[model samples]
Target chain A: MKNNQGMSIIVKTVTRVSVWLMVLYAWYIILHGHLTPGGGFGGGVIFAIAMLNVLLAYGSEFTEKWLKIRLLHDIEAASILLFLIVGILGISVLGGFLTNFILKGKLYELISAGTIPIFNILIGIKVAMSLFLAVLILAKTNIENGGEV
Target chain B: MMPTEIWLIFIISICIVGSIVALELKDILSSIIAVGVVGLGIAVSFLILQAPDLAVVQFVFEIFAVIILVRAFLKKDYHKEEPSTINKVLVGVTLITLGAIFYLSLSVFKLLPPFGQPLFETAQYYVQNGATDTGAANLVSAIILDYRAYDTLGEVTVLFAAILGTLTILRIKKSKNSQEVTNEK
Candidate 1:
């Protein structure tokens, strides 16, 4: 029952050192989206790219152990629903659909942009999960063919 | 920063060369790499035009797009057939037409406002009043997530539809696969 999979040592070492750093940078990009150039979509894709890198270096087995594909699908669906709920709550609380209803914080403050940051987090999670699931399914396809893939 | 014209020239030249390299390279991987170079060149053009937001978006999009394309390529045969003469003729015609169109468009740029300067009233409003109106420092974020929040939601909905479509296709494949397994059993 020795099932060690994935690429050679060099790629694994590189991924080990770089992937977490990229994930952290992606979080920074998502959090500071209102104050910076990249927002949820871009940041989320970057985060997903890091996970894809892991899948590339370590194989689907490692990825499955880390994050089951079914869970990824659920996370993506739930995040989309959460996004809609956030919008509906805006209309309920402020009487305007998708209104920037959160109280304005001090300029340049972390909590200043109100709903934008929250939306950023939601969108980031949604996009990351969606991309990861897509990549995972595609990579794992042909697996049922006696695991020839 | 270099002069706008110089930046434009560098970007355009890189784009042309990259596109040609992508078209002419015999190796599929090299062609994809060349296409990536073209993508970077276009993103640089966006940055030169003072749209960092667009540049960042386009650059990240290009990366993922290339990844997906590469995956698709790996799933198939990499045939190296020479492009037909008709294709060469079409490329020549297209390039000439595009060159003529670009030359014509160069004159039109002078008639338009300077880069990053909003010409329309609404755009001007965003530039001048966005900070106070939306209470967000990044005007682009304020516009996309606040002022035009509904539009962004619609865009995200479209993305959801696309993802769902892909998932449905995959699920069908999985179902067919399971049926085959059961038949074997």
Candidate 2:
């Protein structure tokens, strides 16, 4: 029972606790993007970093066994498709591509900003999955090569 | 409170010093850490300049950059090989060219508008009516996600292409590895 796939227990425990918090913070950034400094790209990068932290702590082998890379690829593709669809839908509704079609509620509210939040969420997902997939592949390749270039 | 110019100058000097240290350091790891420090200085300067969004992105990006660099370094030797002898003539020529370029660019720099003042009216419009039009309190977000969404779409497409390229390259490597294994068997 080598069980040496990841780091020491202390690091694993800390990562397990912090990973969820990071995800929550990422969601906050994405959801409140219109009202905050960070928007889709920033939130998405934060989410990707959270996933990367998990991979680093758990090792690629354990992570791949648990997390399906195929599913991530599908989600990434779907998010991009949805983003494009949203843009096209604005053309049909408002005669402008990527227009703010939704009803913009009062300012400073959570649900205001008419399609901006939607875009934020979609972009966040796309970015997170894209980055995670890239890093996952890199980690897998490195492992296969036995840490050689 | 001290003027923003003083704060900017101080932070920029720190960044310059840190970069010089990073370049001069013998240990690769220490150099990487020095670069990280310079990035932190830049993030701080961004914050001082009232660009919290850029500061946040820079901060997180710096973390990722340092992590990736350190991880890659771990896979190989940490110590540098021998330092190559510098060519004094080449250095002199490079310095002279750089100075000439700087001298030529001074006129262009003078022609540029002063800081916090833009020659374009579009910026003024965005700053004034961004929140009212987009219903987003953060003007930066409003501009990015609402006003110039097409630009953001283009950026997302670029990210998608980069990821697609990475996966394709890695997948080809995997297939080659499998083929080699099968041939050996």
Candidate 3:
């Protein structure tokens, strides 16, 4: 069975709205992570689920085209690499690894911390992309393995 | 009488019951649905504990596990009755032991006890200084990637191992493919 089918117009609309809302909420959580409870991992996964919803509603091909697997792969790799580089640079410049305040800015602004926001975005992208890959692999396996899924 | 506490209790009860249903359900599909309920419960519990980072990880892994399990179970036969008595007994004993442990732990350990002061104090110290020092508002993020960077790296590696193992085992190999065809005798 297709992931998205036999849905009333209302259900489809609700799903679409919720998916976007989740994406927005994920960002909210990540941006306010320092001041609030949620952080990079939390927000990242929520965003990933939101993406998954889109894939389920449309199709894998459309979702992949929208996200572009190549771009997703690059984002996934870049994010992990960025995380590591930030730590290494921190150790070199501030005598500790992953130190964000080495070149601190205003606390509340977008670019306040030298690397917190950057790390947040990187973590978010890495998590979402890896999860997307996992879902893709699972779907492909289900089809290739010849199951009712 | 606080509203949040009431809501929390209800959520916990739902989780416990949902897990029981997952363990007991005869239909595998329903069992999977119950597992999703259990995951939702854990995520809510994480939110209440002020660990949104953990909650997201829980949610993502929960969905991944359930989907994989469902897919794998789809091609397999489950019409035969399972020897469920042993499973039930094991689950019962485990739950009782956990409950006992939780009761004893919470009753004996005070949150702000002298011995616990240092632990919490350090956490607070990080919460305060972490933002300025790490320039990250999320103190948990600072603690995870800055204070415990090595640990986080180790965890990521562990996750990678688990995914690798799953993919390797689930893949249909040539030898197994031939055996499935000829071994029906």
**lDDT (10s digit) by residue, model 2, range B26-100:** 788889999999999999999999999989888987887787777655553455635869888998999899999
Chain A TM-score for candidate 1 is 0.87
For the predicted complex of model 3, DockQ is 0.25
- lDDT by residue (tens digit), candidate 1, B35-90: 99899889999898878888988898789878876764555456453655575788
lDDT string, candidate 2, A1-149, tens digits = 12228788898999999999999999999998888888788888899999988888888877877779889889999998998899999999999999999999999999999999999999999988998888777666543342221
Q: Candidate 1: which stretches are off by over 4 Å?
A: A1-4, A142-149, B75-118, B175-185
Candidate 1, CAPRI quality class derived from DockQ: acceptable
Per-candidate DockQ values are: 0.44, 0.54, 0.25
Best-first order by DockQ: 2, 1, 3
Worst 10 residues of 2 chain B by lDDT: B72-81
How well is each residue in A1-149 modelled by candidate 3, as lDDT tens digits? 34424245675577778987888998897776655566677677778778777766665656677778788767776777777887788778877776654566766665566666666676676766676677655654533333221
Ten-residue segment with the worst summed lDDT in candidate 1 chain B?
B72-81
Task: Provide the TM-score of chain A alone for each candidate, in the order shown.
Answer: 0.87, 0.91, 0.77
Task: Say which candidate scores most in lDDT.
Answer: 2
DockQ metric, candidate 2: 0.54
Off by over 4 Å in 3: A1-25, A61-67, A143-149, B1-11, B50-119, B168-185
Could you tell me which 10 consecutive residues in candidate 3 chain B have the lowest summed lDDT? B112-121
For all predicted structures, in order, the TM-scores are 0.84, 0.89, 0.70
Instruction: Report each candidate's C-alpha RMSD, comma-separated, in the order given.
Output: 4.2, 3.3, 5.8
